[model samples]
Target: MTLSTEGIEPISNAVPKVWHIETVLIMETCPMVLAGIRHLLAQPYFQIKHWLEVSMVVDIPHIIKRHEADLVIMELSGEGESILDGLKIINQYLANWPSASLIVCTALTDDRLLKQLVAMGFMAFISSRIRYRP
Candidate 1:
């Protein structure tokens, strides 16, 4: 059966009081990551409001605010682009949206890098090698 938006019920007494949909912005440069997310959250319960591939993290805040996104799934590859740059972007975002949840969908294999990302305000991290949805 096809999932219909009309059949989806809103969670009762949700905090925001706006009956606003919780949207996820898939921000990954990798095609596989994008495809995986598209598959993972394709269930009726989750909504993929938008998918964007940004060249810089500086552009993230505007997109988040404009979309009023509930979560962000980003690709964190410590190669090519320095992790420091990514953290800087997160720091800037925290200045405006401390409560926004950002889940890093990275290929990093080191536990230290994972911990660092968590400290940098990523709500959660899922290895790119994993395909299961939370």
Candidate 2:
């Protein structure tokens, strides 16, 4: 005996598909670092939708919101007062966009500073200075 075919719909056709492209914003004062980051992210494997670069840390909040960045890569390095200011800005950015992920790349290896940054909602910390292992 053979069964007769009835009306049926595939799940893919029933539900609307949505795609989200990841966007990145890089805030770094150093030109070489910025170039390196751009080059790395520009590769097809990263699949970055948008890449925004800014030298001033103060513009982070504005650019992040404007571009709807999925990730923010920032370089945090400065003296006492400048570091404090950068921390404040970072805090403000996090407070405004709790969903956004922030990564810090800095030459400063101070334990206390890293702790404070983690507390301020930094997703990851990367050391700019590479130690030679010979």
Candidate 3:
């Protein structure tokens, strides 16, 4: 008995061009971070058709659906109970949308919160610095 593998074609090693079609929905409460991310992802590789700095929950579902976001970048500011509260909000939202990659940028990178955030399932956790552009 002989097995035939007639329909196999080798892929090109010439770096098969990747056309980025996935849209990213940036949700930041801070204006500066929103602007920063917008500027950073303005390269040819990415297409950001829609971006929003959400100050309220009412607008989140609409933006997420409208943008067809592959990635949801969130920036959280402040500390103490405030930060935890924000984390709760983020965690809830992320729980709802497991498909969306959540990258969190926060002003406070303390060990405890970092661990907690990691456990909560953040794709990337970046320190909040004005010079820090991810």
Candidate 4:
């Protein structure tokens, strides 16, 4: 005997699919900034996997490699050596994990710096002063 019925519907049509939760790694110096970031990503769609302070900038690449984070949020404040270090860290991270996204949240308003960051493959740049009412 041969089976000949062909009227089955797809399971995806029957049930709603939940958004995939993206794992995030944060590198920030300020406690208030870190707290704000935690609050912002408290939704079900984002899972924070690791937190790194500014002093641990050199270890960022290693942490990212180990965690395989989907996104990295880094604060790029201050001037002189700190800015240079931030740039170097970004370059190193991209060299190892080109697919992972990087976001720079800084108070800097220099257009040249923004352009340079974009050229270096940062996915987004958000101002630290941005307020969300929702």
Candidate 5:
């Protein structure tokens, strides 16, 4: 069975109302990748805040308090452990932004992992890899 977006529900918290136009929090270890994504999003349309270190995500609750983003995107670029750690970090802050969306971007094409991510309240899992046909 395919998981539909309509079936996925947003994580709800009893936070105050803040009418924002999509505040984004990007968690990535690569500076270049972070810069590229930041450049893509318009400043007026989105409030983009980034967490640079995957290791530093242990202090995610405090970081979320400072950044306060509605959309949290994680780049799964490292090894299996890092990917697992990233998911853990994202889950911790899910309560920080109840209505926020969490999305994972990776080159991995594992169907089992994709199913797990969806079940974990990850609204989207985007493949970052690009293939060119000759």
Candidate 6:
């Protein structure tokens, strides 16, 4: 950025920017992983509001609506079939909250599934696979 001297003006009419602390929701089938996520997000920055077990609940959209989540992180590791199921469930609910971001973490990295997620307007896709050491 360059400063203009010829057209010098007072910087008094600027509007202040507002920062918002994000509310995050994490849902996973594994208890250990879910607990770990909660502990990690217990930081002073993030507003961790909702933690839902994917297996325990059938109506994911309802839960999401009740929470009105801003950020949703789902782990698709334990249940193989749940990857698609969770995606579909969240995708439908996303219509209600267009500003919400949905991210998925999984060990199985499938190109087709990733493409599908992108098509469905998913925010991010994270692969949790570890490389084999020879």
TM-score to native of every candidate shown: 0.66, 0.72, 0.64, 0.69, 0.59, 0.63
State, as a TM-score between 0 and 1, how close model 6 is to the true structure: 0.63
lDDT of candidate model 3 versus the reference:
0.65
lDDT of each: 0.67, 0.76, 0.65, 0.73, 0.61, 0.63
Clashes of 2: 0
Q: Is candidate 1 or 4 superior in lDDT?
A: 4
**Where does candidate 1 stray beyond 4 Å?**
1-20, 48-56, 77-80, 130-134
lDDT of 2 by residue, 3-90 (tens): 6546767676675454344788888776777777788776655676777877777777778767878888988733223776678878
- lDDT tens digits by residue: candidate 6, 17-90: 33243466666665665666677666654554454545432355666667666777776534445566666665
Pick by TM-score: 3 or 6, better one: 3
Residue 97, candidate 5: Cα error in Å is 3.2
| TM-score quality measure for candidate 2 | 0.72
Which candidate order results from sorting by lDDT in descending order?
2, 4, 1, 3, 6, 5
**Mind giving the per-residue lDDT tens digits that candidate 3 earns over 1-134?**
98785775546434444435366655566677766777777766565565455654344566776655677676653312356556766777688877667888766658898888888887998665566468
> What local lDDT does model 4 show for residue 88?
92
Mind sharing the TM-score for model 1?
Answer: 0.66
In angstroms, give how far residue 14 of model 6 lies from its true place: 19
lDDT winner, 3 or 6: 3
Residue-level lDDT for 90 in candidate 3: 70
| Local accuracy of candidate 1 as per-residue lDDT tens digits, 37-107 | 77777756554555455644556667876876677777653326776666776777666778987887777
Best-fitting candidate, scored by TM-score: 2
Candidate 4, residue 46: lDDT? 50
Where model 6 places Cα greater than 4 Å from the true spot, the runs are 1-23, 49-57, 76-81, 130-134
lDDT-better candidate, 2 vs 4: 2
